[model samples]
Target: MKWQNSLKDYQLYLKIERGLSKNSIDNYILDVKKLIDYLDANHINISPVSISSEIVQQFIYEVAKTVNSRSQSRIISGLRSFFNYLIFEDYRADNPLELIESPKIGRKLPDTLAEEEIDQIISAVDLSKPEGERNRAMLETLYGCGLRVSELINLKLSDLFFEEGFIKVTGKGDKQRFVPIVDATKNYINIYRYQIRIHTNIQSGHEDTLFLNRRGKQLTRAMVFTIIKQLVEKIGLKKKISPHTFRHSFATHLLQNNADLRSIQLMLGHESITTTEIYVHLDRQHLKGVVEKFHPRK
Candidate 1:
C-alpha cells in the first residue's frame, strides 16, 4: 500500500478502534511522517509493507541525533503501535519494528498540589474584580471535576445538570461522561454565571461557553495557564505548578480519601488505570493507614 494511504487508514484506526484523542492521533501520525521524511531525505525508497528491520532501526538512530531520548522513545512506541495495527489487519506480512527496543526511561511523576496549597491559591484571588467570581468558579471546577484545562475552557452552560447533581464533561477524543458536582462547586459556578457573566455582552460563538475572557470571548489554554501561574506567584508556592497540578491534586485527594482507582480513572478520563496510579504515590499516609488498619500484625 502507498505510504499516504496507510497513514490515513492508521489515523482512522487509532481514532475509531483505540479511542485516542485527536491530539494523540496527530502526534502518532507526525511520528510516522517524520520517519518517511527521513527516508526520503536519504533517497531511500521504502514502502510501508516492504521496509526491513534494519532500515527502521537506522531511521530511529538517525532520529535520535535530532530529538531527546523521551521524544525518541515516544516516536518508537507510536511507530511500533502503527506497525502492529498494520500487521493485525494483514496489510503487512511481517512487523519490521518487532526488534525495535524503546529507550529505558524513568517514570516522571506528575506534580500535585496539597489541599492547603490549593486553598491558599484560591484564596489569593482578589474577589473585587469582575473576573474574580469567574476565576473562583473556574478554579473550583478545575479541581472539583478533575478537568484538564482544555476541557474546562470548552465546557458549556448546557453541560450543567445541577438538579441531577452531575455535570456532563466532554473529555479527550470527544468522549462524554457525567461527573457528580457538590453544592459548593455548583454555588460558585452559579454565582459567576449570574453575577459576572450575565452582565457581560458575550461574543456570539461563546454565548454558551462557561468561562469567558475580559472581552467576553472564550478563555484560551494560555489564559488558563497564566491565571494559575499568577496565583502560584502570589502564594510563593515553590513547587512547580501548572493548570494540570489542579487535576493531579484532584485525583490524589480522592484516592487519599479512599476513592476507588477505577472511579478515579473514569473521572480523570484516563483510558488506563496505570495513568491514574501515579496519584497513588501522593497519599503515603493512605498506604500506611491501609496497612495499619488492615494488616493483622500491625
Candidate 2:
C-alpha cells in the first residue's frame, strides 16, 4: 500500500474512532509526515508497510538533533501510535517501535501567575477601546473558570447558566462539563454580551459564539494568544505568559486556598487526578500548611 493511503486511513481512525481533536490529529500526522519527508529527501522509496526499525531509528536520530528531549519523546510516541494503528489494521505483523524506548525526562511543571500578577495583566486592558470589555471578559473567563483557550473561544451564549451559577464547557475530545461560575465572572461576561456584543453585526453562523473578532466572526486560537501577549507586554511583565497561564494560576490558587484536587480536576475537565497533581507541586507551602494543620503529631 502507498504511504499516503495508510496515512489517510490513520487520520480517519484518529478522528472517527479515537475522537481526537483536529489539533491532536494534525500533531499525530505530523510525526508520520516527518518520516515521509526524510525518506523522500534521501531518495529512499519504501512504503510504511515495508519500512524497518533501522530506518525509523535513523529518522528519530535526525529528529533528536533539532528538538529537545521532551519533544523527541513526543515524536517517538506519536510514531509508535501510528505504527500500532497499522498493526491493528493487519497491515503489519509487528510494531517497528516496539523495542524503542523513550528518553528519561523530568515532568516539566506548568508556569503560573500570582493573584497580583493576574490582576496587573487584566488591569492593563484598555477599557477605552471597544474590544476592551471583550478582552477583559475573556481573560476573566479563562482564569475564573480555568478553561482551555479552545473552550473559551468556543463558548456559546446558550451555555451560560447564570441562575444556576454554572457554564457548560466543551473540553478535549468534545467532552462536556459544567463548571461553577462566580458572580464576578458572570457580571463581566454579561457586560460584554449585553453591551458590546449586541452592537456587533454578528455573522450568520457565529451568532451563538460568545466572543467575536472585529468582523463579528468567532475568535481564533491565535487571536486569544495575541490578546494575552499584548496584555503581558502592556503590564511590562517579563513572564512568558499565554492564555493557559491563567488556567494554571486558577488551579494553583485554588489548591493553595485548600480546595480539593478532585474538585479542581473536575472543574478543569482533566481526565485523571494525576494531571491535576501538578498544582500540588506548585504550592509546597500549602502542603506544609496542610501537614501542620491536620497531621496527628502537629
Candidate 3:
C-alpha cells in the first residue's frame, strides 16, 4: 500500500480501535511524516514495506543530533508503533525498530507546592475584584480535586454531584471518573457558579463549559497558565509552577498524609501505577518513615 493510504489507515486505527485522542493521532502522524520527509529529501527510493532497519537507524541518528533526548526517544517510539501497526496489517514482514533502544533518562519529579505555600498563593488573589471570587473558586477546585486544567474548564453544571459528595471528571481520551469532592471545594464552586457565573451571558457553544473568560467563553489552557503565572509572581515563589502544579501538589499532599497510592491513582485518573508512584519521591520524610515502620529488618 502507498504510504499516504497506510497513514490514513493508521490514524483511523488509533482513533477507533486504540481510542486515542485527535491530538495524539496528529502527533503520531507528524512522526511518520517526518520520516517521509527525510526519505524524500535524501532521495531514498525504498518503499515502507521494503525499508531496512539500517535506513530507519540512519533516520533516527540524524534526528537525535538535532532533538533533545526526550524528543528523540518519543520520535523513535512513535515510529516503532507505526511500523508495528504496519506489520499487524501484513504490509510489512519485519520490524525495523525491534533492536532500537529508547533514551536513558531519569523520571523528572513533578513540582509541588507545600500547603502553606498554596495558601499564600490563594491569598494573593484580589478578592475585592468581581472576578476574585470566581478565581478563588477555580483555584480551590483545581488544587482540592487534583483536576487537570482541561477538566476544570470543561466541567459542567450537571457534572457537579455535591449532594453525593463527588464531581465527575472527564479525563484524557474522554474517560470519566468520579472524584470525591469535599464540602470546602464544593462550597467555593457553588458560590462562583451561583453568584458570578449566573450573571454572565455565556457565549454560544460554551454554555455548558464551567470556567469562562470575561467574554463568557470557555477558558483556554493558556489562560489557565497565565492565571497561575500571575499568582506565582505575586506570591514571589521561586519554583516554576503551572496549573498542573496544583495537580502534583494534590497527589503529593495526599500521599504524604498516608493516602494509598491506588486510591490516588484512581482519583487522579492515572492509567498506570508508575505515574502515581512519582508522588512517593516527593516527600523524603514520608519515605524514611515508611521504611522505618514497614521494613522488617528496620
Summarize candidate 2's per-residue lDDT along 159-263 as a digit string, tens digits.
999999999999888889999999999999999988999999999999899999999999999999998999898889999999999999999999888899999
By lDDT, the best candidate is 2
lDDT by residue for model 3 over 1-298, one digit each (tens)?
6779889999999998888767789999999999999999999987788888999999999998899998998898899999999999998888999998989977888988999999999999888876788789889999999999889988988898898999999887788999999998888888888889989889998888777888999888898889889998998999899999999999999988889999999999999998899888745776788889989999
The C-alpha local distance difference test score for the whole of candidate 3 amounts to: 0.89
Lowest summed lDDT window (length 10), candidate 1? 278-287
- Model 3, stretches more than 4 Å misplaced? 291-298
Steric clash pairs (candidate 1): none
Evaluated at residue 123, the lDDT of candidate 1 is 99
Error of 1 at 47 (Å): 2.3
The Cα error of candidate 2 at residue 250, in Å, is 0.6
Quote each prediction's TM-score: 0.91, 0.97, 0.94
Q: Which 10-residue window of candidate 2 scores lowest in summed lDDT? A: 280-289
Report the candidate with higher TM-score, 2 versus 3. 2
Candidate 2, position 163, lDDT: 100
Q: In model 2, how large is the Cα lDDT of residue 15?
A: 95
Candidate 1 per-residue lDDT over residues 1-298, each given as its tens digit: 8899999999899999989888889999998999899889999997898989999999999888988889999999989988998899998878888888888887877888888999999999999999999999999999998999889998999999999999999888889998888999999999999899999888989899999998999999999999988999998989888889999889888987879999999988887888888777855676788999979999
lDDT of 2 at 57: 89
Alpha carbon deviation, residue 277, candidate 1 (Å)? 1.6
When 1 and 3 are scored with TM-score, the better candidate is 3
TM-score of 3: 0.94
